[model samples]
Target chain A: MAALVTVLDLSLGPLTGDNFVIYRSGLRWLVSDGHVCRAGEPIAFCNIGLRSSDGEIRSTAPFLREQTDFQLTLAAPMPGTLHQLPDASRGGWLDQLDRYQHWSESFIPGSLDITGGAGNQSRWRLIFSAGERMTELAEDRSGRLTGWRRIRRAWHGERSDHGTLASLGTCEQNGVFLGEQHDFSELLAASPGSLHVIHVGDENLVPAAAVLSDRMRRDAGANALLAADMTQAVLGGPVTPGPADWHYAGSALSALTRCPLSERYDLLSRQGLSPSVAVNAVVLSVNAEPKVILRHRKLGYRAYWHRFRVDTTGQAIRNWLNVSFEALSRTIDDIQTDLRELCKLLAERGVKHVLIMNALSTSGGESIFTYAPFSQALGDELPSVRMKELNLMLHDLAEETDIAIVDVDSIAAGLGAAAHLPDGVHQSGPMQDEVRGEILHILEQRDFFAPPRA
Target chain B: MLLELSLPLINPHMAHARVDSILVRPDKKIAIGQAILELTVDLSDQFPHDCPPVSYYRLCASEAAWLRHLAIAAGEKAAVGTLLATFSKTSDEAVENCASRALRTTVVGVTRQWQPW
Candidate 1:
């Protein structure tokens, strides 16, 4: 009988849900190809970034600005065979979309590794081992391997080839050897079948969803779906606005020292800046050109002041205010509607299990201020209020549809105000744990996973 | 007229709940939709076993009323429909009746007792 492969497709993008890039940049690969990793094991290290003191190749783009000097590491998303795709170094700037499409097409469903990274530094690595003996390895600064001697000895005790480097390298490829190579195919063949839990959310859901997908793969042998750059679809809003609508902010100190916006953009593009890397570059433009700044200031003051005056005087401002609100409402409604349609489509495709995460509220209750530049100019209360309304809509939809709602708000609220960063949206460890736990609970309730092998 | 607010059946499977905290106090005027009390529903027996047995829920007031009497104290578990509190139209009436229900109010298991209001 053919071995059943459980391929987990992770679709992550820059600015998808909550800012997963910060976590993604920090990830360090742990398990090799066809290696087993247990649930909650540190398969990869995330939330750590790369930094160089020599000021090597720092792009002036806002996102890559800070990355020029330092970087954070993100954790390994799941447990499976680590199948790393070709690094971005092999492709040029224009070839990225094509490269990504090819990677997705070539991906065999049920594999845990995901594709696409920011630049040459970022690449896809997957964990394919579901339920095998987890061999733990240690490494030093020079990328030398340690601790594999014991595992090798244990697997091939008294064998003539036990301590050989060639044998060690071979053992690393598939699974541990008890005189013969133990491939993951044997374990997978024993299972019933595979199911895919496609996560559709922004960056916040990325790391948590990845971990949850890993857990599901380890415990239930299901394929957790992920994608690169599905933010616009999941968020139901414009992710990359035109340069004209982009807002730029800077501290007085930064403004003084900052290079011109055009120069910075040129520097960034010259350095092979990706859309993911451009997220912050668009916002934190410290040295905006004088002309651009003056133009923006005039436009901002005129638009805001006029609107404020109109609002206070009980008159609509060119009916644009209502149009913006209608658009926002429509966007939120479309998010729900799109999710429902996605769920229905998945069900028709024989996917009975679906988990949808509701949009989480910012910690300080100020998501509006954070998104002011990209979104329409609305009062402080509107964004928060609309978020609550969207969450409520999700709850109602879950009850009516086959989809199960993951209460991200409750998880955020449970963690208290300090769990959130100053930005009020992005979360780290505690929040990730909460969201993961909630997803696991939901999956368990649905009986999504198969019974563990005795 | 006096109105009785019982421990509502937030979840159909919820058999018992512990009062996590009380947001409102006796003789305090609370508006409609204001949180009255926080309840930790005991979900140990529900599906997805091994999860946190208790889920927190904030029971809010559906109608505007003055909290008259506290029947169940914080950290106490009561069956569904247990009298949680009583409300009246006026604060004076609530304050006047607070003394009568003082003996019945048995406080237990109260932790992080906070009055943000």
Candidate 2:
């Protein structure tokens, strides 16, 4: 907007007097000749630019914006600092507002190593601690509100494996400022499957965020609907070395930064930026078993890397994996309690619907992850919340109250299991699409998001 | 009398611009004619080019009673399209807020006789 203002000024000359005020307020384009306010009715005062006094010509140009209920989510160079760009040639505020990417959620279940406490740290593999919260909510630092783009369908028709390394590396293709701690160059180097330069002690750039982005993109089957959206935060960068000193980020980085959507224009059509979407629900793990992501502890930067345990055991819990009967029952009981509390908290945040996504019942006896884990082995900790049984419980609950229940069981059962999940704890790549799809199906079939009629 | 207005810019079928209001007091009689006039004056300044100014003149009480007897001649003169509204009070707060911001009500409800355009 600032750049355009300058260009327009150079071309059109100084807007003398009230014309300046009109242009500055963005009302120069919308001034209407006259209007009527019948009696005492008050309406949202929009289109101030179209309003005109008497019957004189004010602005003779088309409006700067294609006025719709569209909300713009400005991503990057620090979304919070659009008004303060140090450089102007790359097109400052005007170019920034018309951003390339839309929304992103990066996750890093950083390495977990208990032996580090005892000093044998370098030898251990970094544990991929799961993210506990279902979703992390944030906005552009420059005080922009993020809104949902009422999408009728997912951008990709069929979920495809765009490659894990590729997705993680995409974020670094274009420079990004993670925060005050890490810059984009380091992040780029960390991605592309090599992070020898990044030590575990310097936990900023390399964390579970890279893994989460890969999982989400591959699992969700698309990079952010828009590229370079700040809504997402990265967990860990891939370990890819480069020539000389420049970073070598891979595919996921492209998926994160400005590759997928930038490469394809159709995906952006479904993307919309808004102030917010009413959601803060838990992504409970339906299965009691946990998936472990293997990560390397880039040693030498610090004494030892400590294990960070993300008990994604709670909010991020998903069903479909095989677990001890006790673990499954215990997890469900705990998750139910958490949901009860979430309902109270979410109500204050204006959430009306609470959806529970059903995990695929893939452990129908032959799954590898379920082989060692049958409830019969555990005497007392028997699992009660099995897949089919949980669906019935959810069905019964939905009938009893307004709490909406999304039956992911029937959908996933027909679609089969995802191949990427380790130990069958988390969802596999394409399976996530099937999962999100089935959930969306149930959501649409049922009145999960039916806005109240005014 | 309730005057139904249709604004074409809005959906024509849904053109009834509703001014939902809650009058706190109960059992108090409000002159409907005065209320309608107030509204017309309020919207007087809008749509100056397409929608012409309406009902610029008002009638005094003594003249109003006499005009009502002469059925052949007098009516509210504010030209809000074709329909001329009849009212008791010339102005209300709602009217003042919506009236032409530049036009000053120099004399309160002066009785002015004029031919309908």
Candidate 3:
């Protein structure tokens, strides 16, 4: 029997900006040619750059922070085998730099041979990815979303009025949202409506409730004071900072000063460049809420870094951290209060949905038969006990606020934590898929796809 | 009866584990259910990156016994099935015997509130 074949032209659709020319580099194929692709699977991507029509560039230009690494990943509109045109791409700088060709709506670089079906779709569904590099010197063009980005984001759907979901969780959330490729493959395939996702790295500073709330409310004077104090500490400290230390200081300062919750986006859609307001939904992780955080003795700001990450820093920054910060313990009530304040501030910003991913409270390898030898205050000493307490507190907070728990505890438990979540933190592939489905379900329940609020 | 302490597979993704801290001293009586060893399994050891998949675990004694010999120390990396320590039912039992089996232990995942710095 002969397999039915239909050619579906993959054309560059309407990608525009006001008084600016949007140019794209040659196609960078994610998958090899003749590879069968699933529907909505990202197959190829290209670097996109914006240049002024009048040859005038300014610091206040739109997407100034993201213009350096702006890109668009093209997804397969339907299931088919991808076949690129012979002159589709010229390797080297011709494919690396975005100044080679202007974006034309009718430009067809490739065609999909749909097997056993006839489809009329010709326009490529765009998945836009942008990264704000930690430093301009850290240029890595190895793969999509590569290099050191202080903030990385991607969005899909052609509608200008898209609902944005900001991910401010730990690595657990990172795997679920960004997938194994770090290009949002699973999320893009699953999300049917207009959706935007932004992920902020937690390598330098964990985005706890205290840190996030502080970032949301910090002012210019406070930012100036923080920058000055950091500068003095790293430059004039007892130990001289090396290149590694300076790089860490710069990236850490950038993470500390920026407020992701209040960030606006310059979105490129089928119509043109549309300015998006703050995110419609924010997802956090209960795992990020530490029981103790470091507070600067003189500056009065809070900071927390993963133990492994702190060990990797240079001696100068380590010395600064050890001397300049004091440890403050937080009780369950304190965590609840911080979350409450964060939700209040977000609500004031007109955000209606706050989905928090609860921690996985069970371990497959654990078999604690007794607590006779353990500390008396189990909730304070044991990780599982404290997580249970925190999860309960989140349930209580949900009753009083618009916060919704993503309920990873229940989901992991239901899916068999031993096989899915081995160490109680990082999840397996099946586990991540389940978490992604639950997140999208929660968004659907909250009507996240409805028209944007005025 | 003599018992041995060998590294068990704590995390599925980890091929080797590091001895973060050993809480028990050899020749001392360790109570059942008491924490005896702290181990760390970092996936970054296998897949190196900035934000590694690191986890902490504590191994508690499942049977009361006299600690006999220690084979590993803190800051040492051991592969799975490597003997970590030895124990005996009595304090003065002969330490050289191959008739006994691995020690019974209960592994618990833990969290550290402070950083190494």
Candidate 4:
């Protein structure tokens, strides 16, 4: 008898842009490492410098600046552990400016001492000694000091109450520096799993599914045999497949997993965000399990929500959906055919099992009132109704083929409209949990604890 | 008593790996948690890159014993749990006896240098 294969392929195809981390500019971190935060909680404060139209620094004080010039706080987009980037690793707008300034100077060793003062104010005294010259600075909080080289050039001239040459136009306000304006912090903890995640949706499903998959794999034995590629059904139209391009969905997945691409098409398609010719390449590649890659092909899918100018009114979107319903239906059929072929190929490759997740559309509900026209148009066709048709198709395919269906729509509907954001398609944490629960349930039923092949 | 030291399944996805370099030498005394060898696992096909997935494993020895046999050499591919070496608590007498016995056992017509007891 041949050795038993114990590899599981977990794929999360394209998701709507929900899983992508948005790195904003001009942030001063307030959260500590390993701090758990809820979604929408303020994690950091923005201390963006005010710049004039001519690109000159307007004010040095961030607190005294106008709201237009400085955003007060930066909030966590999702709930998870906050892994703050180290201060040395921080690089952003301010770092760029510092690099551009190219001020070269040799700095002597500095010593920091904390001194307690009146009114519960503790002062930090930083003393610097260069050659025979000694400089002392006092501040309530310690931050990067600037213009020191220029002040050092004029230090012999005079002394002021601020301890520096005030006549040289160097004051504490002008010298004070805000360290890092913007930096990145990962929210999720390191999930324990060997299963690879291949994301294929726009942005809606991937983030939640990735988090859930990590948890699920941990619950199942560390070395259980399982393989699955959860491909998201086409939401709107049939995209022509050719000319390798890179998609953010795929690039993001690849970057997250750190698994190198096996085939050139996977690399080209992911890098260019173009239609992929080798959709089945991952399944075909040997030892492909426990790897995560995205299978997105739609162009401009990431920014689709923000670019809704074509249908300012609900009427245009409604007319477009109504008119293109046939094309959309045909595209669904093509997708179904492609999936069927993929399942057949996977089965032929000696894959013991395969699981397919049904696609989900937004529930228009009352949430549409927030973005009236776009929301109204999305609700017009009852997107869930159309998605249900695809779901049923998957069910029929499951009965006829080796594929098993995980009904994400029923799960999403049970959560109601509020479970989703304004986009209607993207889900919040609760909805993500429901979807993950269903997948875990399916895997459990499939006998995750079965003995390895003899 | 004779003890066999075999490769461990460091990664579930890994089937077989090439011995990059042996950190321990034959007849050298080793301790628990001491790195014994470095294995270069192929992840090139999965992730096309110049760098391969390389990992080092430490010996989980139950007792102090002289390193006796080297069934695998550097650049040689070995399956998970393949007998790499053996140790004896008593003396080197068992090592000579085990090596002679291993010479007779054949896998696919190739004589194996170390046998798992």
How many residue pairs clash per model?
Answer: 46, 84, 0, 37
Q: Which candidate is the best by lDDT?
A: 3
State what share of the real interface contacts each candidate retains: 0.00, 0.00, 0.64, 0.00
Tell me the lDDT of model 4 at A405. 66
- State the lDDT of candidate 4 residue by residue for A1-454, as single tens digits: 6534221111111111122211213334556656675644445442222233344433431212121222223344344455554431244554322222211112111111112212321111111111101112211111222211111111000011111111100011111111022111111111111111122221211222222223222322221211111012212224321222113223322322321121111111011111111222121100111112222233111111111222222332323223322211123454456456645544453334556555554333211212211222222223343455566667777777766665655665676644442233344555555544554355446543222334
Q: What lDDT does the true structure give each of the candidates?
A: 0.34, 0.23, 0.83, 0.33
lDDT of 1 by residue, B1-117 (tens): 566777766555567888867888887877754657767665653455321334455555545677878888888988887888888766666344433321111111111221111
Over the stretch A1-454, how does candidate 3's per-residue lDDT look in tens digits? 8977888888887777877888889988888989898888888888888889865557766778888688888888889889988776888877778887988989887888997654557788888888788889989887788998887888874667678888897888888988989888788678757888888878767999988888888887898899999898878888989877887888789877888876667787776777655778889998999888888899888878886676777999988888888887899899999899999998898888999999877666567887777765777767888889999999999989888899899988988887888667778888899999999999988899765445
Query: Where in model 3 is the C-alpha error above 4 Å?
Result: A1-4, A32-35, A115-120, A451-454, B1-32, B35-49, B53-55, B61-105, B112-116
Query: How well docked is model 2, in DockQ terms?
Result: 0.00
Q: Relative to the unseen true structure, what is the C-alpha lDDT of residue A176 in candidate 1, on a scale of 0 to 100?
A: 14
Please give the distance, in angstroms, between residue B89's alpha carbon in candidate 1 and its true position after superposition: 38
- What TM value does model 3 have? 0.90
What is the TM-score of each predicted model, taking all chains together? 0.27, 0.26, 0.90, 0.27
TM-score of chain B of each: 0.71, 0.16, 0.93, 0.62
**Model 2 lDDT tens row, B4-37:** 1211111111212222222112222333122112
Where is the poorest 10-residue window by lDDT in model 2 chain B? B63-72
Model 2 stretches with alpha carbons more than 4 Å out: A1-334, A344-349, A362-393, A418-430, A446-454, B1-117
Model 3 chain B — which ten-residue stretch has the worst lDDT? B108-117
Compute the lDDT for candidate 1.
0.34
